[model samples]
Target chain A: MSHAVHSPARPSVSTQTPALEVHGLGKTFHIGGLFSSQAVRALHRVDLTIGRGEIVALVGESGSGKSTLARCVARLEKPSEGAILLDGIDVLKRDRFQASRTFRSQLQMVFQDPFGSLNAAHRIEHFLRRSLTIHGKGGTGQGSEAQTRRRLEELMTTVGLQADMLDSYPHELSGGQRQRVAIARALAVEPQVILADEPTSMLDVSVRIGVLNLMRKLRDEQGISMLYITHDLASARYLADRTAVMFAGEIVEEGESLDLLANPAHPYTQLLVSAVPDPARAGSYDPVHRARLRQAVMASTACAFEDDPHQRCSSEEPVRHQVGDPRNGHWVRCHLYRPGAGAGGHALATEPLPEPQPAA
Target chain B: MTVSQTSFGSHEPVLDVKNLTVKYIGDTRSTTAVDNVSFSIGAGEVFGLAGESGCGKSTIANSIMRLLKDPANVAAGSISFGGKDVLAMSQDELRRFRWQDVAMVFQSAMNSLNPVLTIGEQVADIFTTHAGYSRKESLRRAAQLLELVRIDPARLKSYPHQLSGGMRQRAVIAMAVALKPSLLILDEPTTALDVVVQQEIMAQIKDLQRELGFSVLFITHDMSLMVELSHRMAVMYGGRIVETAKAHDIYTTPRHPYTQALMGAFPPLTGPRVPLTGLPEGVKFHNIPDLAEVAPGHFVAPFDADAEAGVLEGAAQ
Candidate 1:
């Protein structure tokens, strides 16, 4: 078992500022009667931060709060607790004007289903034109309409689309084309950070890589910090620099993408890694073993062992511990990495985590 | 592995779809969803159709079942199941032939189950409609079908929403195979499911196919799963089968450039992360001109240099 000392929380490294900092984010949904019997806690004290120019992946199965976390970052859904700080400003605390102004070119989101996200009634040029006009990015020259058209063509070319697609409606285009259009639209705003929630899952497997490669190109050229949310570890590994594995609304494990993937510290991470189909090792495990492992993992409660009594397992809340060098930014939240004993130094120095922003 | 168990049972093909073409008709130009697709399923064989989305895998499936709605024309080809031409049959005849001889389990088909009805009644409905069985007989058969699919017979009373995704899928499988159809068409059957659930569903389906001696035309986009489950596989590209070969050969040495790209396209978890690759730099769509047989029982669609050059020119323009 990979082991390290347990540290519940640690302060952000002083020199390295986070592009987006989130602390103690929470969301709850109430259902049923006045004396409501059911209150679903979707997110509980979720804390995550994406450093500048870094692509942090939020990965999990459906309902694991990966999408919820993405929505929270995008402010598409309001969080019940905690702060969302984008580039040193608390977005959740600022006024509408201040928030919009700051976040206008700062943050933007790309949805999963390109077809569903795009307006079917509008032509491709209409969307690109609106985005460019709204952001005041297009040229202010003679024959400006022509210039805008040229700019739209340029954007289309950049996204692996053709000039003819400008007049084409969403319905006329295939899924990959629509996604390319969506990416072009996102690029129109020139945002510093892009939050893509399963952006390629709905696309064909053959076209999925093309979109992912485009995103990587954009990230490198534009220096745009991206939060790529996906359930597939392979895709996440291909694109993301760091990956935070979320399970039932908590960041159960997080680390450098390759390290965490190759040496998954958490049980949940191991289960996810094992779940990925590797053609090399087909039929290694029988149906019985697969079923047993799946059942055991699913039945395990979300509450860390310490929090709930019935939890025969130790702490359900991971004992946040560093696996590799902090400089490398590898952190895991599992008992397997109990600080100070297993792999590295026994007593890791504790510092206060980033402070929560004041409420609006 | 189980293919041999029923190989000698019948020389007759379970399903032979010849030159099948489906076009969604409209006021102007109709949209061709499937074009000149020809394939046959031997008795107890799992004939896999692997393709990306919009490649017409499901269209062929829908056409085979005669479940096409209005404005949808079956322009050409014949779907012969158990020696009966399906496309040539009238609506009345098709209805009688549907569940009794040919069953289809669509992608996310578990959702097709009625949330209001118990699993038993839904499955029993198949028997009552197709076999004209009494309620008592249908219920007993439903329980037995559930057993065959590896689900507890007690789940017959459970609503569709009450079961796990795997169980719900099993329930759907139970319903499909309730009448023991000679041929089963599964269209991306486990697409919506996770890998573990997907594997379990595949295993259960394989077990049932082996025991009951039914041929399965398993359709999915995932190549690895196809290799694991399929006896013979066909790769579809832009409404055409670009390649058809034994599953082992397709994996070991894929002949088509499209197949080569597809096999190398996916980044597996355990493997070293290779930068995601695609068709040539500017290829818009996945359409190969013609499939050529490279070996006995193995066919591959070669990359058309002219077509590739044309696509590049279009991109340039």
Candidate 2:
């Protein structure tokens, strides 16, 4: 494969500061009027980082607050707490009222639905050209017209689309093609970081890989950092360098993609991995057991592991415990991995912790 | 295991679709949505039809339920359920045939439910209208149906919005199976659901089919779920059934290029990662030949020169 030779080594963590670092990020939504509003914590002290030219996947089920984190990072929502460091600078503290033009140019967001993201009334070129003009990359003058046309063709080619597609309306393009146009528009601003929220979820199975490959190509060629958010674990494993599993608005597990998925530490992450339909696996899902796990996970605000003997799981929040090789950056937030807990300590942590059996 | 337990193909199929052709008649030109496609489901069997969007899998499901409207017309075909001609049914017969003999669960069926009405009222409506039961008796039976799907009978009083996405979908399934239909057509039933919820729903569907003895015509684009659930499966592309075989055979040794490509689309979670370029760009398999029995019980469509060339080029890249 072409990418086999071109596949760069996984970016080293300590050598350079990350392109984007989110520390103790939190978001809470209030329902009803101010007088009698109910506070819903959509995000809880979330911390994640995307190294330069690296891809980090934020995976979770629906309403797990994965999308909420992305919205907060993109400055679409006001975060209740924590810092968003872009290139070692805290953008949240600097941009108190609104996101400045520099912050906007440095960070771009690609939404899930390609059909809804693109305007049906405008041509593909119109969207791309508008982004370029807004970012001061292109203009309407006669001399700049030629330059803009060249840049437009370059964007189309980089996304692996024919230049002729620029003249076509958004409706005429396939779902995959529309997604490529969306990515090209994001790239028009030459942003250093991109946050894609379920980008390939809407495309057909066959065409989905094309878009994924395009994202990988962009990361390799342009050295742009990205946060790929999706509910599909297989795709996350296939594309992301690092994977973070989210549950009930909290980061439950974070590690190298292959290591985390192959040996999930958190009980919720284990249930998620086992739930994915893998033709290679022999046994089928047990609906009764799944129902019990689902109920336990949703009903409890503390640890999802119901079998934990330690009362700390129910009474207090679990902290991040280093598991497996420390250099691999694999960690989990579960009471089972507490320092003095029977299951605590590394080396033997390559396998999953003890299975959690919900009470009858 | 489910497929091996049942003695399929020896008995008359519960649902037999033969030479089915459906077209959408537009003003400029008519487009064939489903072209000369044929498949069958035995009693208590699960038959999966998989393809990308606009591949006519859903169109086939819609035609079976007689839900096609206006521009969508049945161009040519014959649909027979239990040796009775479905296309020849009168308005009254059609009404009786639907839900009584054959039921359907559309994509995102959870949202199809009315928010204002309670789940009990909705499920009981089926019994009162179809089985001619009293309102009290229907409500009692509705509670039983909810219990069968493992939802609390007390939830029968709750509105659709009150339940979670998974519970609402189970409620929809309970209503579909209330009439004890012989065949159930499920079109992308778990598309909008999360993986865990999707697995739970599928497992429940499998259990229900076992207990109730009903055949299933499952339609979806996800191949992994199809293999996990279906007994016999068919792969469709561009309005054509390119391959049909037992689920195991389709997963192990898929003959059709399109089927093989579809299998390669999903990346493995385990194993050394490889750069897999999913279905080649702009390569549509046109002029597909009819399915031939290449092996005993396995059928595959012979690829034309154009398709073979396209697939080869894609593989080379």
Model 1: per-residue Cα lDDT over B104-195, one tens digit each: 88888889889999999998998888789999999998898887766778888889887766678778887887777778889888777655
What is the per-residue lDDT of model 2 for residues A88-138, given as tens digits with 9 covering 90 to 100? 899999999889989989999999999999989999999999999989988
RMSD of each: 8.8, 6.1
Identify the runs in model 1 with alpha carbons over 4 angstroms from their true place: A1-15, A95-101, A133-154, A291-317, A324-328, A335-360, B1-8, B19-36, B68-78, B90-92, B115-120, B136-170, B280-293, B301-317
Which candidate tops lDDT? 2
> Cα lDDT for residue A40, model 2?
69
Query: DockQ for all models, in order?
Result: 0.34, 0.53
lDDT of 1 by residue, A286-353 (tens): 65554443333343334233354432334433456666667657766644222111111000001111
